[model samples]
Target chain A: MAFATIRDVAQKAGVSITAVSQILHGKGRFSDETKALVRKTVDELGYVPDSRAQGIRLSESRTVGLLVPDIRNPFFADLVSSMEEQLYEKGYSTLIGTSAEDVQRQDAFITTLLGQRIDGAIVVPEGADSPGIRSLIDRDLPLVFVDRTVEGLDTVPSVVSDPYPGIESAVDTLRQLGHRRVGFVAHSSLGSVNVNERETAFRAIAGELLGEDGAVVVDCDNSSRSRKDALMALLAEDATAMLCAYSPDAIALIGLLHDRGMDVGEDLSVVSFDDIDAFRLMSPQVAIISQQTADMGRQGVEMLLARIGAKRKRRAENRRIPTVFVQRGSVGVAPQAR
Target chain B: MAFATIRDVAQKAGVSITAVSQILHGKGRFSDETKALVRKTVDELGYVPDSRAQGIRLSESRTVGLLVPDIRNPFFADLVSSMEEQLYEKGYSTLIGTSAEDVQRQDAFITTLLGQRIDGAIVVPEGADSPGIRSLIDRDLPLVFVDRTVEGLDTVPSVVSDPYPGIESAVDTLRQLGHRRVGFVAHSSLGSVNVNERETAFRAIAGELLGEDGAVVVDCDNSSRSRKDALMALLAEDATAMLCAYSPDAIALIGLLHDRGMDVGEDLSVVSFDDIDAFRLMSPQVAIISQQTADMGRQGVEMLLARIGAKRKRRAENRRIPTVFVQRGSVGVAPQAR
Candidate 1:
């Protein structure tokens, strides 16, 4: 159980403790052979650098906090996984938190994160206005937003999907399939910028492609009964094609459709946001607005790193990763056309 | 942008700094009004306690490192989410890492976690042998293994699912459906104790239920080619029903079946471990061996808390949560019986 310390590595490598530290930190000049010897000995002895002490001395924790609404959502899971991978490669650990889409939880996590004194943070905000986020901004910590952005936090860089291209293409596809009525099902968290943008895009594009009256919209809370009500309202409108502003809502609707013994592609065409793995594996694959989550994760980290490394203060620009429409078996000809 | 100090909170609350500290830490007696006033002032000023300093002073970071092989796996995602929730409720922040099922990455994360001076760690290990795990044990830090365990680290408490009950019930279901041949398809990560146990249970149960030659086993290397080969080999053995030891493999197999224009419930029966959301949403729902991940997460946290709170040192005991079999449309009559 004895841990190998700097002294142990130095003794074993036949070098001074100062030399070992310099070699490990890659600071002072050392011969290649000496560096190799030190590294080999460090590996053999399993010497882990005391990053806590280093963080105190160097004023850099080399750890970044990642706050997401929920990891159970596959999109967030992929985002966390991707960011962690890239961050690890850059020699930084990830501190993770889930807001559970609750403002209190988000603030609590942010409080803890600030106490940790992490070098930076990337957040998928629970809502537009968070006192915790405000504190982060006030402290001038390197921070970036991913997938979702908050209100009044315009100066912070965000990596979000541009919903227009994907919504336009989906509506056009539905129009080409002779669908005159297109409905949008949205999560009830209307404060979310992502949801607002997606719904707005759907409303504008579906209105243009299928006429103003064709664009029906309904909101559903994250519950089976609410989702059922939303679907029923959409069906009552005689809409044969629908888009889900949220992926989980789409998944629930598909299950509801199956429960009613209605074929998805046959009875009602369906498309949802986020190209999650489940959509690809479905019997009749569900089409989606691919958000390119990998790109978002990669760029979110890059933006945060850019801020962390910035020497001069300036306005941080928001970046958008374009969302693209992916057609699959979920979208088919309208029932009336059939 | 100036952070409110503890002295500022004390002044605003009309109390001494000693009283404020005592009230905040719940360490000293204070009048109810004084406590309430201090709390309100702290909240108004957003005075977050510096946990990093507290961690050093108390030698308790109030942080737990969680290392999972891959969060993209829904099972792991759920596990991480559940554990983080429970840990946070117990007043701890989670430091997260993903090994991506690589031992080097696992060791690197372990090193970083150790350097962070976390109070404890919970790991879903990559394999049966990890030098990082050995270091953790050597350090005598409170640790718990979930879902999977290591070979040499037997004394470490593990919360894993007992595969016997689920596999036995699944085999019994297949037998009742007139399936004389059953196969178990597994990921190539046979070193994982979970995979090994499930495969073993499937072999024993299938053999006992359907006679000696009824049990067939195949391994896939997480590629379409490998999964296809495994499925073809199972079909070549005339397996009317198959259980997936790993969920992703089952998902891949289902996709492969769809690619070949085969109906899962009608043409071939499919059952997979882990009752993921996607399984329930499938047109013909996939039968599953449910691991009760929420229970596992809850119990894992409880066990870790017990270890962390134990005043007297004692050897920890391993806990097993029972797995149950759920029948759905996927398991049907054998082709021959039909």
Candidate 2:
């Protein structure tokens, strides 16, 4: 329900807007009779001075804007929840804008956040180059980029997960188990720069392990109608092991295997990136390249707050949080035990 | 990133605030030099007129507030996502407030929303008796309750899934499969009235199908450390078929069974309420009672929009969405085969 503004209270009190504003602020001169009538109208209308309205006059709303990729993904959902908890403790409320991994929507939301006069912003950028984001930087608005950062905008503070350790460990473990022909199933569609980072690391490491043939990249989007066919193609390959580069791809592959009656360990070895609850609960619980999502969220807030408070333009924080491999039962000694 | 406020432009232009406001609004008398200076300053400062700040004076902010129990729950996450998509299509942005299923948090969020001047609100109430909610009703706020309703506030609009059909089907299916002893595992600690509703329906229907002795109700919360003990107790019973009253209980049971090397459909028959992604991917997919979560969200937005545009007060919407049972592989012929 909308609260009444000073104008509404003034109209109800049959007084000038100034009279109502003055009485409400407990300032300016007014007759006792008039003040009494205004006070009564205030009580009757339940008109408390809207602090948000006051915030517009002053430039401090204590509201921060958060741009996430998507909420359906539990990883991002958990990130939002954790960040909101931290922000709430610091007397700030989060206004969420989900990009859904679309660059246009990301730019539009950036425009909206700027027009809303947000005190600060934290964006999980869709792509490196967006005019709206550039405008934010030009204005010297306190901002923190998380999950991924735009290239060449190295001066902007950001927090991104280092995908190397997890990818490295996964490669080492599979190699140790004699899986030379390991296929890397990558979802190249989601616009997160982390996808590119993982792919780079994967190709480099898989190249080192099994040469160019084994550093195979399967570009698929989880939403694609042909994803199942692509999975089948990957399955028919001579590769002894398959690593799902993302959760959605992992889920899609798992479902396809379920449909084909092919067991994970016996028929194929598999792993995925980004740990999700469902991944752990699967029969042969999937191994994953895990990110510290909560820490990423918490640090993003703390860094943004630091940016917001600093009088001098502080040096940008381009920090890399580490990822690790959480191996369950999914990856097995290669099916062809070569 | 934050944008420069009106004050910033005023200060930068070396002019009085009123002079800048008048020039920007194109109102009041101002010298041409003053107007030109303000315009140039505005361009330099990138001062886009903040419509949201303007919304402070107007009752309609083109913003709707949505309160959910928790965002970490994929169920609620999906709900928020679907609702946001609909609201976005209608050119309205949603302000999200997750209560985290805490009554205190719910109340604080309620207070925050009320002060926000949101045009309308859709709440998944934590509990019914918050004075803040009652105040929204008293103030004639266009509000819709989703997922749960207050005990006496039957006059308020609401949307909830009818748990009866799903419960009834589970009992009937298990009975037809030759299970004379069916145990029902329930979780009532979520503080939603639907918990009570499901429990009552389960006991009555399961009693009718499998006798009073077979209508075993094991009550526990998902977060409780004793959920395993409760499950062990349920196992100790002579029940051949089990019906999990909620998703968390179903998940916990599945993990426990997997850990113990007890396969579903081999050691026991199981069915759960709410269709989650992981359920279908399990070795023997768990059967479930699935709710139209997306519909619940879409309808909540439509109903709130209707309430907002209503010329006169209308009877509250006590709408009930139907739930259907999705039969997966988890359920099989009772071990005793009569």
Candidate 3:
């Protein structure tokens, strides 16, 4: 039940494998009679041309490789799903790989993509420094970075959320609600470019809205103890508003807050990044800094297609998808006067 | 900066393409000098041998194709992430494609997989009948179905959740809470084998525990209007306990109940399937008929690897991961007498 290879088709059709390969690819000079014989033998032997071999002979696989930091994250899952659907509509199949935020794993996927000879690639890079990303740029692969991009690689086109508008609006809203200071909580991972950018944006915005010492930022590991410690630090700082740079942290904080008999929107105000479905289902629907994931996915694919269509010309333009603040029930006035 | 092809290597080494290919693959007779020349030329030119071309020459790709129905669904997202991790540890790269519940998309992925000459495949079939599945079977491709199986293809090995244990326990617990009947809400899509099985199991279990009419099943489309209609129909039937066969429906139903000024756990007990992260973040921390998604992902990869290692010897065994009922605040005492 093995697949009939070109050699088998050639043997059955009384020709060389090179003739069969060239005739099937519509390259090289071959008589009409020879082409007919090869086609008949191919059907008779049930030969499905190995696309990889065909890609070698023709230099196009019509397949794109994509790398995401982590698919377990809902935002990434949604982004990959949307990009896959759009690529499919444009007659390209996607090869998806997840790095799980490991630089080595990202390199491995990059090597795999190169070995597969994909037409182009879309990636959420692991961080600011990625040898794999540098290699892709060095090799001149038609590439687009989405969600996150390597720092100093401005020559590569990327689509990332601008964080400024969302952070500004959120800080302004909290300030208007009588909060003098806001606390920010996020994962302590230093390799994430987006999270670092988000935290920096919040700090600047809060400083402007509520003064120099208004931003209380805590970077914690994913352990429950660390999250609780972050919460305690916020309470000790007397910050009435809590901003989570990561959504999972927000969920964990809510659970911890509930355990301590604190109402989320009443005892302490809260807002977080990523509009995941869980936020809407929470008791007090949490406020969100929405990164337009669908637009990023669509525009990433569009940019990659344009680069591929332009024959690997590097596009130095970096596109930004502006984030917006959506106020749900999770924001409330400060428990004490300013 | 394009990749150096076999032709490029052969030209630089002053040898034929076949000689270079055979030398790289360690096949066919060639002089040591010829092999060394090809090797040196490959390194000098930075030629990454096309893995697909090598797969044709030697029928192994060290790659597997995976097909899931939807990636945006957290359950599927988690499943894919876990499976990809496991496969990566086993020295294989995964090519993932989502059907999005469209048969055409599923077939397209299948075609792409076959063209790519994958070493094997693990698919959550789109439905009971798939011409693509039939083709894989006909070609004797190493295949394993996960989460769901095609209706009449028992010859292929599969890993699916056994719904009886979870459904029976859930229904029995509701009955103990003085619920006379339980309403089951699910998608009206008839194509899903898993959802249909879950519904059927609920019917059988509820009938045994609370009499024949005790099982009320309402299948609705995914629209909000339809979900609301299904919820209203469940209320009209006077069913005090609600069993959602799908997780998203449970989320929507809970939101609708909140809007209608009804407490989920107090007014109508609820239990749904899939222990997704959102379920834990819900106000009432949903009770779930856990499918053990992590176990399913691990076992599916183990089975596929076994089959792939066995070289496509058909294994007719269907493995089942038991489902367990987890009682949370969502499964409080039903508000009616028997």
Candidate 4:
């Protein structure tokens, strides 16, 4: 027997093929009874509608393109997982692209996704002003920015944590623990919103706590060797305590300290931002400024879905998920001499 | 001026639209000079070939479907990232779906990928026997299994780790350190090839070290809560040392030991499989049996690409990547009296 197609189901259900396609795609107008009857006919007929055929008819692939900075990073992994969960529940497939923190790669990914005719995109923009991303926005493609925001594009919805408050709280807590000269080790400059916000907050809090001179910001280029160098510079400043902007840098800092025979919590108090699975398992519990990555991912999907379902165009909204300070054994009281 | 299309590029390059399309898709017979000319024309004309149009013309989409058991797991995360990198270099985009360790969810993901008309699929099968996966195989889909292998399927190529030597080494090291009553805590049953290999090797090693009745295996369902129960059971065995089969389970084991005021290395030597990111950072280092996940992913892509490019059908091949045992502070000389 020949395999039954959507045409067969539609003919059996006595409805237009367009109606059958709509019901299958979960789009267009259809009443409950009609939908149920069509579904019943589809089941009874054993009609396996070819996805390619449906795509051709609807001109919609029902796929969303997801572009992340780096998938090796645990934070992106969690984000992608959460996004997939929410998007899957809503009947959308995800096409993922990793930029590897390269602007050229980001541009290439954008072009590839666009060429694939993805329904929309959720990109963690590579830079604050990526021209390729700007072109995507210009083309009126539905875009949702996650983690970081573009400087010029105020219309793209971004789901990110308000890093300033979290940084302030972290600095305040360290200061309260009698730490005056605190050092900051960040992976990059204030180019990205999150990094800039964190550095700005750290500087503000430092000024309030111990004047502007008290805060020392060391921007590490994020390479492992460079991070080690940055750690050495930060430690050389005689800073009693240090705040890490990300997990990899924090992990590297720990290794550097251990190599130099510096006790983590005793000799140098350290706090890392962005808690990952590995961090919780580490021996000397490093204090963490943990962002709700899973929550951000879940919320980002909801926002994207809302945009997809809206009748009229919606303005871009920046949703700030909260971050909490997880104080582990890594934070200690400053010594009397220091 | 109107937006440059494939037709414009063809006209500008003085080539037939079919030839230009073929060159763009990297299909059909075309000289390198002609291909370069078309590419140069495309660049100069700023031509953007519509992916929908191209997809319709060619039955094969330049997209591979990737179905992972869980993305939040760092192992899978790192694997997916590596696969994406390799596939991207080969000009194939990846559409990712997470099954969340559910067979039903995996089935759903497969069906969705089929609907999207993915060129091929690389799945990390969640169960030993998945009927949905079987159906895909029956349909003659190009499928490659990674990390885990499904039972009763002989035609699918798979990339996995040879866990025997690693497990044996871990057991031997533990025994050398005077751990006679050693226990094993696994997150999943001995159904998966990797898990089964580890279990079989551990059992063999245990029998050699402390007779047949000495080996204690606690199989825990892969959940955070269930892992705690498994840890408790393993601890109750009064084993001098415990070998955890996975990293997340090891993290939970450490927490459980700490909660009970049991020193990890001194009271009960703890060793885990999979040296995940945070393991080294943990207060007490957890000895780990680590797999080369990146290598597995890269190899999987290479094999899949070869299959895609093969002129004649090649027989399915199974490749085993190596694993390493990194002994840190977690595994030590078993307690003096235990």
User: Cα lDDT of all candidates, in order?
Assistant: 0.82, 0.76, 0.82, 0.76
User: What lDDT score is found at residue B4 in candidate 3?
Assistant: 54
What iRMS does model 3 reach?
A: 3.0
lDDT of candidate 4 over A1-338, digit per residue (tens):
23356788888899999999889878998899999999999756545444333232234556788999877677888888778877878788787777889898888777555545456789998876866786577556678999888777878998988776667777888788887789998766435667667777778778887776789888886566787778778778878889987677787777667556677778889998887865665546778988888889888888887887777889888999988788888888887545
Those runs of model 3 whose alpha carbons end farther than 4 Å from true positions after fitting are A1-58, A128-131, A177-180, A189-191, A213-220, A228-240, A256-268, A281-284, A332-338, B1-57, B176-181, B189-191, B212-240, B256-268, B333-338
Please tell me which model should have the higher DockQ, number 1 or number 3. Answer: 3
Ranking by DockQ: 3, 1, 2, 4
Question: Clashes in candidate 1: how many?
Answer: 0
What is the lDDT for B1 in model 1? 24
Clashing pairs in 2: none
Candidate 1 error regions (>4 Å): A1-58, A189-191, A218-240, A255-268, A332-338, B1-58, B189-191, B216-240, B252-269, B332-338
Tens-place lDDT digits, model 1, residues B70-132: 888888888888898998889987877888899888887776665554778899888767667
lDDT of 1 by residue, A163-275 (tens): 99999999999998989989899885656767778888888888778887989899998777899999999999998988998887897898788668677888999999998
What is the C-alpha local distance difference test score of candidate 2? 0.76
Which wins on DockQ, candidate 1 or candidate 4? 1
Model 4 misplaced stretches (Cα beyond 4 Å): A1-60, A128-135, A176-181, A189-193, A210-241, A252-270, A282-286, A327-338, B1-58, B128-131, B173-183, B188-193, B209-242, B252-270, B280-287, B326-338
TM-score of chain A of each: 0.77, 0.76, 0.79, 0.74
Candidate 1 chain A weakest lDDT stretch, 10 residues: A49-58
